[model samples]
Target chain A: LQGTVTRKWDINKLLYANNIEPEDVIDRVYNRGGDESEEEDIEEEDFFKKKIYKEPSNEFDSYKPHFSDIEMLKNKWIFDNNNSNIDKEDSAGNSPFALISRRFILSKKMIGEDDS
Target chain B: MAKPSNIVFQTHRNFRIRLILSTLSGKPIKIEKIRSNDVNPGLRDYEVSFLRLLESITNGSIIEISYTGTTVNYKPGLIIGGQITHNCPITKPIGYFLEPILYLAPFSKKKFSIVFTGVTSNKQDITIDGIKWGLIPVLEKFGVRECELHTIKRGSPPNGGGEVHLKVNTLLSSPLTLHVTELPKISAVRGIAYCTKVSPSMVNRQIDSARSVLNKIGCEVNITSDAWRGKNSGNSPGFGLTLVAESKKGWRIFVEDIGGPGETPEDVGTRVAYQLFEELSISGAVCRSQLPLAVVFMVLGKEDIGRLIINNNQIDSHLVHLLRDIKKVFGTEVFFLPDDNVIDQNNENNSILTVKGSGFTNASKKIA
Candidate 1:
């Protein structure tokens, strides 16, 4: 886009300064019509009224949610719409230790047998 | 005060974005060894043409190219945008030049009204319709007003002559911070099947086939056919399709396809239809071509962080380099947080991209 014109930039893992997604929107003009589960759900406010509700999901996290299901789509929308935990471990790339800062790793003064 | 050092770069891999960021950020830059080892080295015709267009719109942009065109030293000046005309090289579609200019014109000191003549639709880049319908609304979200891109004439590609008039008024001192993180689902589908100097009947064939595919999606589909004759059709003979998906939240995704030699109108229709489906299936709020513009605007907006929703599968090697170049020029870094809201809770496919803006205001814009 010239890494070997240098594509090495491709292999370099992204540096998330505050670690939102070890990765990567809409205006929430929320409607109250689909609040069948609002009894068990909590409403959140953004620039507009928004909702956050959990959907049924497998624990290991290998599922690609189909967009055909309206309920599933709504859950995915709410869950992604929340940016509060963007830098958390769940939002990081390597599922487990996604938010481990590169700066922290670089700051670790390791000898590696000190064979300079 | 003394001058700041320039952002040094090598190769032409990411030629356009660097210039765009440099211009928007007003940072001096020096690029070296652009296609240095290629068969015919140095700046290509389109690259030079883009530089010329930049020079035309700005007051004091000093662009210096080495004898071999392998190197360029550009000290960007304030954008003094006004009515201007540019004849782009036929080597590239006008989309190449037009797309980046949209990133700039809003910050210009004067109202930007320009007439660009060249290829309008092609396989290589986003067609003019894509720009008019696709990117403009996205710009609106950023608070830019009075934007218009009109296709005065249609020119397909190779042996080309086309004219497009673009006007962006209401000098925006700075674009609004993008707060859109939840990409609204597409609610309607709209499209255009335009043909110039070809069998007008082909339009129907293209439209019907595209409709065949889109009808399955179950959105209110409307594909309009436009046939341009005589001078308005430009010099080349060609036809193409532009599809735009709109959401209630004003999210628009545009996809275009042009007919190649021996390629049927039906084929063009199906190609573009499938392309739209592919885009819809992907999770990004912005399409591949629109990604650079969206990301850059976020970095240049108010210092507060701007967030965008995108799919990991959408990040190509091109974007990888763009993110790196953005850091070098703007000193702004982007955050990538994964999304695990899927039925399988797959955290890797989707994520929110956050960038703390540089809060750039147009220095040349007169305080009215």
Candidate 2:
């Protein structure tokens, strides 16, 4: 009489010995909608009360191309990233949108500009 | 000079890169919250069979949709490509309608040739052999030399059917200057592995467990197994793989995996060889599903300055809403760079994006 393998079947121990719920077995094998009550009807303090508009610390020191604002220059050229004081020494008669706002301030002060 | 109307957007992200950049920027969009907070919301028989394959390749296109398809609108006419043949909607595949017909098949005015039955490989998109080995050689490096795709059968998922065809060859009267900025050296590692109504030794046990984990990373894979049968195998019983790699200057990467419901052809060949060795250990020149077709061919190429170097955490949210709809439809901005020694040692995904293009011409009708 020798028999003792004492339980170890894994897939997280046979999903915890079959009370299952790995998102109800991945929502019954992927028909999907493992319902978490429609994600608790969305409200984690409305993402900490949203609001992040920033940009005006002297709007790039008077670089106003006709008081720009083509929707804030297309949301500061697709979502502002603080191009460190763009002034690449008089961008020779600028405007292809001010030479793409001085090539977005020389792409944040060029770094491996073309790796070499 | 006035003329620059409609262009409001919202939810239902990258809906075919905003209808192929609003049919190549004649503009007119509208969109609204599709799947409006879903609980069976709207717009989904594969987005109304991709708006009936964009109202069968445009001509006085209008579109509309709103009695709860959660708003749409569209407009975009004139892109009159020819021979179409869709069907594709078993909940999306046929590489989600062959990736906006490979971005409006080289600005179609003629030779486009589609076909497309349904579901050709799953795990959510890009797998008609990763658009025939990584997007027809990145649309033949943008000159688009008479493309072709083929694969007339081999569907998967619950009961698809599968077919394929594709053609392309139109653009190039100058425009398309890519400039991939070096990251070459991975000479080989091709693949296929396939399988159909199962057991053709599950495509040689998923190509001998993806060539024993791509021969422990020494590369030179060269897969190839297939198996298909009867009516070129469809009504379900899967298996998959794909891979790609390539490099030696002409780049590629791809990856795919498949084999669902209790997976194991050695767990879909060691998880598609560790996702093609984590996308060839990412030292990018575009790969992250070809960074939105290399940012829509560097925002419709040739105005110049078109650099690449990708991987910044694989940018997603549909490549940040296609870079804010390519700065609201081609005013073209894109710039990023970053990598000042990976932002001074914090090392978050590398960067470099740059762009300037907008010399986007393809004025249609160029057949011969």
Candidate 2 global Cα RMSD: 26.5
TM-score of chain A of each: 0.15, 0.16
All DockQ scores: 0.02, 0.01
Interface RMSD list for the candidates: 19.6, 20.8
Candidate 1 stretches with Cα past 4 Å from truth are A1-116, B1-3, B340-348
Give the interface-residue alpha carbon RMSD of model 2: 20.8
My TM-score estimates for the predictions, one after another, are 0.76, 0.32
Candidate 2 per-residue C-alpha lDDT over B229-317 given as tens digits, one digit per residue, 9 for 90 to 100: 78878788788888787766667777776888987787787667666655554436656676777678778887888777665545433
Worst 10 residues of 1 chain B by lDDT: B340-349
| Predicted candidate 1 versus true structure: per-residue lDDT over B236-297, tens digit per residue | 89989989887777778777878999989988887777667656656467776667778888
Q: Which 10 consecutive residues of model 2 chain B have the lowest summed lDDT?
A: B341-350
